[model samples]
Target: MSVVTGCASCGDERAAGAAFCESCGRTLATGTPPAAGADCPACGTTDAVGADGYCGHCGRLVVRPRDHAETAVATVAAAVTDRGLRHHRNEDAMWLAARDADVDAVVCDGVSASFDPDIASEVAVEAAGRVLASGVPADSPGGLAARVGAAIAVAGAAVAALASTGDPRRAASNPACTIVAACVRGREIGYGWVGDSRAYWIPDEGDAEQLTEDDSWAAHAIGLGIDPRAAAVDPRAHAITAWLGADAGPVEPHTATLRPEQPGLLVLCSDGLWNYLSDPVEFAATVRGAVRKESDLLRAARALTALANERGGADNITVVLVPIN
Candidate 1:
């Protein structure tokens, strides 16, 4: 049997004695045999590296898909997610679906402090996206707010369930994530969120506005009559008060509805983008400038992502844009 070894560069398995890795095409060090007890690349634990390329001690990956990703729906909507310069991996996920005048989108940012946070974000986005795209009846009594709320609940449940598995690490930290979801039908929009992920309405000719209130310490402090500047400077300002996780208690998502009288853009993003442009007016202008410069949804999304990186991407960035005409 040909012995199989993992490529250190890209983490793909390669047959022993192969000159190059088939996955990433990097030259392999086939001549020099691995030391008797090699240290794991991530955690530096002796002889604790697994054949699959993950560190047995720390479970760190050599590489992963979605380090950067882009998706589009004709010219109507687009989304981008990137690992950014600081993070070891991309822990943000987004989903976009558009049909005619209807669109459904979701964005989730993993809690870095939690184990397997990437999985939590991925599952939350998928669950919320599916619910948003379920084609809730137009004449339904509960209407879009209820639909959006239900999507958040489903996403929260999905993230919470990650702790139910046998992994003690998962139970300890309990994979967690923040979610923001939006659904657009004709000229009306419905949105909801948990944690700091945000949704903004940027009109073509008027002031822009943030649709969802953040469930974070800063916002709570501001509500309690603390000065905005004082609240923002606090170390706990960005610390989320609500999230999707087994330990997050009840997931009471904040939801709202919007009916724009003029043409605009609906923006959904993780903190990576907003951290640099928290002002609604600046965020709207930047997005508008990108759309005008690129004249394409996918390219505009990419431009926004590039701008975030240029500004020192301290966290995973995710941006989703849906044009409302």
Candidate 2:
């Protein structure tokens, strides 16, 4: 008998039942399927999140720690990372923590074409998350935006510093990844991004808005004059123009802030999830439906990932959902 296995992040071949993708450094599955009918953490309802980890009543994702790996900082914030159907492993990572009235979250996607991209993603998120958790700098002149930018700088440096640790091939190819992060305080939110990962403001009663613009070929073409639909279909559409790695030039991070009129969700995600539902209105509706049903932020994040998988799951998916009530 012969078996063939391919990476979930990249289409590289791998040994059967491998624990990690050799091409991308993403974690592989042991062939065990995820469990279903888990209880909803918010409503104490069984099978609320369903087999896919999404709650029907609240439309949130109840983490089934058994079925797949997931994490949550509090009722207000949650994140989920998964290796989709086509990928053998997940090359994405996220970190989030709620501190009093403030919330910090980071999401990173490993560049499939780069060496040890998974390592770059993991390191970047850790460095950024740590900076966010450490509290804002009091002496800093720029405040939240500056702090967010600083976090991205720290993340970039961390990735760049890793170039010397591995083999020569690693230094040559250089692990690379895209990152998006946010620090929210009450009604005010500060966000930053490098590469194509994204952040959005999803309101409870209004239209959703994409906060950070993508740093990719498609976005650049759209800026010049190309129609969005046309630009997105190009061969270089998803190719990230900026990232954190040894080869990446000076990291030109983008920063922004917003204050919503009503309560909503502050969402951060990788291309894997957004590619399936790019329309802000449609994405917001899907999220609003889930949040209304479960009121559990974690379940909401999981539901988003599930939606991506249902839409072909061509790559690893990651999402962080934080309630802004």
Candidate 3:
């Protein structure tokens, strides 16, 4: 007697003497077959799905866990990261944690031009977040600013270490990312940054403030007497002047300390969110309005992300919000 070796319905190889194909549960001696490898939602190619959760035939992503992620710590802090509409994968990463009345948050945006940008962002956020959560001693010199700078340095080292002689991709482009982190204790906030990712303080009643200065061409041009509007329109405007990677030399993260007199929100975000609403006043009003309408930090974060997507999501988005009371 001859043995059937394959499923006619799905084109999947059948096990020895199996009655049905495991892939699609099609009968080996089927009377009528449904369809061949119609499982791929993007492309109905027969048995052409890759192990990386992508349609091999059409090269469309199958939507993985990293596509969209969120976290919240009670009502104290919340964070959200999304792949956005145009990107195939999310390269932005964030970390948020609260200890009693203190809060620590970090947000990293991958340099899309570099290799394994996502990995760089993930490593940066984790390393910086751990340092922030560890907290500095009360008697420590330089106080919170010193600790925030140290965390940025640690994250920079972690990202640089990702490059090696073994992997060709790493050797060629090397993984790189931008980082912005903040630590809030009492009424004081200490923040540091290595690239264009930003930190902002939005007060409930008073004016809003952009905390970190971007290390980018547009900022440099504006500093050199060029009009802000003209600089922003330049093709090289968004090109980052500083980054974290093996190729980046002597990363001196910008650091600052803020003591706000009023209660509000401390926002750490990637360029994706700011690109849409860069104005401090408009940004603050939008965030405050979202918080008021949603009445929840997580939902407000989501609403902001949705707003970015609604306004042509050209890149990955990440936002972290810490309520300051």
lDDT of 1 by residue, 1-325 (tens): 0122554334556534554445433223211122334577667788875555456678766434467767676677888888888998888988766666677788899999999989999889768866776667755876787788899999999899999999999999999999999888899898899999999999989999999889999999999999999999999999999999999998789888899999999999999999999888889899999999999987998899889999999999999899999
What lDDT score goes with residue 90 in model 3? 86
TM-score of each: 0.82, 0.78, 0.84
**Greater-lDDT candidate between 2 and 3:** 3
**lDDT tens readout by residue for model 3, 189-209:** 889998899999999888999
> Mind giving the per-residue lDDT tens digits that candidate 2 earns over 156-269?
999988888858888888889999999888888889999989998888776789998899999999999999999988998988889999899899789877878898888899
Higher lDDT: candidate 1 or 2?
1
Could you tell me how far off, in angstroms, the CA of residue 285 lies in candidate 3 after the best superposition?
1.1
Overall lDDT per candidate, in order of appearance = 0.81, 0.76, 0.81
Could you tell which candidate, 2 or 3, scores higher by TM-score?
Answer: 3
